[model samples]
Target: MIRAVLFDLDDTLLRLNLTAFIARYVAGASRLLASVARTTPVALGVPYVRAFLAMDAQDREDSLTNEQLFNKTMLEACGIPLDDPVIADLMTYYEERIVPGFSSGVVAARPVPGAREAIEAVHDAGLICALATNPTFSLACDRARMGWAGVDEKDFALVSTYSNSTRCKPSTRYYQEFANQLGVRLEECLMVGNDAVRDIVRDGCGLRTAYVGHGRPRGAVWRGPMERLARELPDLVARLDEQDA
Candidate 1:
């Protein structure tokens, strides 16, 4: 029997286009950095962008935390020696200015049409719910996104953020940590999200999964039409109940 439901934030419960958010975030960071670095936004941004992309690529194969990879890549891209004071300053600026701006914007998040109702339904069914987004962001940022998604912080039994987790998603360690925190066996949890690679495929860790159909291109074990996703929550719950019998 499923005792809990875990969700992905972006493009699942929330309707914000993540790719667009990233582009806007990068642009904001570049503009902010340029103001202090005495360089054009694009000029300063180019290296950072290249480094960021490189770090993302490395993340696929490397076990380093996202922050670690980001710092190392930023230093390398800026041609600054590791542990340089300037690098520290730049990192501080990025976190203080750029990161906060991104969070603020997320506070204005849009919820999927039936997301709120679905979550309420889950709660009413006596099941626990949590947000299991990839742990690359801080809790504050995650909260901001939740706010945008029309979900209250109290709605989740646990909210996994980078600060709360040591492993990123698609990694069984990450899902395991969440399962541990909630005091639930993996078999009793259901993960619902839009990313196939990160969310659904995590079934290897033992949680059942439901694929929300609107995000990155990926094959889902089960695909439901986007418009029907929220509307079908009741039916989904019924199916789960029947399966558990």
Candidate 2:
């Protein structure tokens, strides 16, 4: 009955060159970490990339939260001891200070034109609203980007982050866990995102998708930009409810 609407953050709610941003972010982080450790950024950069890839692999049976996996892998790859204080310091500094500072120099990171209004439409329909961005970053990192997207953290019922989520997106398990957290069935949620393959569920996952990307994908029931979504979402939600009834 469309009890919840899950929104993807990057490229969907926030318009930015994601690849470029990742590169810049990794470079900045490497430099910052190297300065503290008295090592070369190049040394830190290699391990950071490896750790990120390990997190993003989306293993269905893994029990660890993405944050735990990231930390474990990052430290192991860097050959640092498990009890090192640097990990804690790095996490704190990166989340609290470094990420927020990126907003100024990164001109490409801007809120999608109608993203906020689209969120409001979900609220107006009385549906649970969730930020279902890939759970590869901390809540602080997600919140910082959400601020750049002009959305308030207070508005969402669920905000997926590395510490909270066990699986990455494009895996049905991620959506399954999200719905379970919201106390709803998968069929009751509609995923709204720009990536066709990553956001859309297949193989009888039961969730429907609304693609907001450039071209229509096979599984998406609706296709349009965020502006159109803002205008039409209530009606669409109503339609889904009626169909369910």
Candidate 3:
């Protein structure tokens, strides 16, 4: 019984050449931070990368928001103090420039085939939807990526961001938290994405799931490309609806 659909942003709904995007993003982001903070570019860049990776780490010691953890960890790695304005400036740049620029030249995002229609199909069937991208990014970044996927920001019921999500993917709590947000039981939702390791791990949180292609699915109900999802989802959703009833 799937009352909601959780869609992963990158690679699932939008097509991204990961290597090319990361190379450009790191370069551009480092440059932008250097210009704004007027710091040693290489020094700032290393901590930036490390901090982002650290956020993705599954060690659940504390429940600090991603901003607090990133700021604290990044400042320590950069040999800066708690009161430094550079950290503040870096966050501002992230929200204002980073993602907008990513969607522009650094990594031009394009929609995966049949993505918009599939989402629309879910909505047409009276199911709920959310953007379940890993919350290590700012909302602006998610919105920009959504644009490339041909999805309007208004379409999602919830957009997960580091500001709100306490755990990263592969953590069952991450899936649980999103289900809680929708005021629905986890067993009544479907996590739909391409990342076999991360997105499909949502099943551990008690939700049903469908695996989009390029990911080796373990026990997902649907396994294929976005085009396949578009074709099969109407029937699949109906099955779930009837089964739940």
lDDT for each of the candidates?
0.69, 0.84, 0.77
lDDT of 1 by residue, 1-245 (tens): 77888888887888875766666666766776566556677775667676556443523665665556655675666644324577456745565555545534543447787778767777887889898887765566676677777888799899987556656777777788889999998878878887777786533555777787655444343466445655666677678768778
lDDT of 2 by residue, 1-245 (tens): 88899999999999877777777777877777677667888997778787788778955467888888877887787764323676566766776787766765554789998999999999888899999999988788888889889997888999999888888878888889888998999999999999988898787988998889998798898899999999999888888889889
* lDDT (C-alpha) at residue 34 in model 1: 64
The list of candidate 2 runs beyond 4 A from truth reads: 81-86, 104-107
**Stronger candidate by lDDT (1 vs 3):** 3
TM-scores, each model vs. reference: 0.71, 0.93, 0.88
- Which stretch of 10 consecutive residues in model 1 shows the poorest summed lDDT? 217-226
Looking at candidate 2, the ten consecutive residues that score lowest on lDDT are 79-88
Name the candidate that leads on lDDT.
Answer: 2
Model 1: CA > 4 A from native: 36-40, 43-64, 79-109, 214-245
Candidate 3 displacement at residue 99 in angstroms? 3.3
Runs with alpha carbons beyond 4 Å of true place in candidate 3: 79-94, 104-108, 202-204, 241-245
Ranking by TM-score: 2, 3, 1
Report how far off residue 180 is in candidate 1 (Å). 2.6
- RMSD in angstroms, all models? 4.7, 1.9, 2.6
Native-referenced Cα lDDT, model 3 = 0.77
